[model samples]
Target: GEEVAQTPKHLVRGEGQKAKLYCAPIKGHSYVFWYQQVLKNEFKFLISFQNENVFDETGMPKERFSAKCLPNSPCSLEIQATKLEDSAVYFCASSHELPNQPQHFGDGTRLSIL
Candidate 1:
């Protein structure tokens, strides 16, 4: 079984600062996903990648959120000019490229904006 991993378990940023997150997808997995949870019941899919190419990004905000799943490096998600509304728990997940395969998730990084 492949396991996803995330760095910086906790992040704190002042308003207008930048916030960056790192994710390591499970070995052998071809699909990578990022999600944001602002409220307990609200989990928003942010982006996904197939190998090093972006596959889907239906939920990512064009201006403030950006992500990369580059080969030979940890996948990264960044938010520029952070605002209080950006505070949330960011999750990284990975799965096989095959359709319907379950995604494995890492413990999220909690981002706090002040």
Candidate 2:
């Protein structure tokens, strides 16, 4: 099984401050993904990268949310402007670029707005 690693178990930010989360994709895996859980039942896929290139970014917000999966570096998801509604758990996932290969998720980083 693949392992996805996320840093900073919790994050607290003031309103309008920037928030950043880091992720290390599983070794030998080239695909990385970021998801935001703003509610108990809501999980929104933010972005996905194949190796160092963005693969799909269906649900990412154009202005405030950006991510990078760079070679020889940990992938990063950044929120340019934090708001009360942006407080949530952010999950990082990784998988091989094969059909039916399940993505492995790390323990989410809980973000709080102050």
Candidate 3:
């Protein structure tokens, strides 16, 4: 099956350090989303991008979290000055439609703040 690819399955960083995660959405998908999972089965939408422009980022933390999706390149999510609360698994999902459409998620990158 075609799948989204996430790099560095696990990452560790000290408090106040920075963490960057990469996601390669499945080919042909036109929309990409970023999520943060803090508790099991609990996911918080962080941001989303349609092609190279951001679609929705209402859930993003204005200060420390940033994401970008550029043509012909993998999408990226970055966390600056990471805090203990930032420890979570970041997942990227892709879809062809905005709503009522099936989305595929990447393996997820687990970030641990120490």
* Decreasing TM-score order of the candidates: 1, 3, 2
Task: Go through the candidates in order and give the C-alpha RMSD of each one to the true structure.
Answer: 1.1, 1.4, 1.2
Q: Tens-digit lDDT track for model 2 on 1-114?
A: 357889889999999999999999889898898999999879999899999999999989878888898779999999988888999999999988767899989998999999
Task: Give all TM-scores, in the order shown.
Answer: 0.96, 0.94, 0.96
- Alpha carbon deviation, residue 76, candidate 2 (Å): 0.2
The parts of candidate 2 lying over 4 Å away from their true place are none
Indicate the worst ten consecutive residues by lDDT in candidate 1.
Answer: 1-10
Model 1 lDDT per residue over 24-43, tens place: 98899999999999998799
lDDT scores of the candidates, listed in order? 0.93, 0.90, 0.93
Lowest lDDT 10-mer window, candidate 3? 1-10
- Model 1 stretches astray by more than 4 angstroms: none
Model 3 lDDT, full chain set: 0.93
- The true-versus-predicted C-alpha distance at residue 15 of model 2, in Å, is 0.5
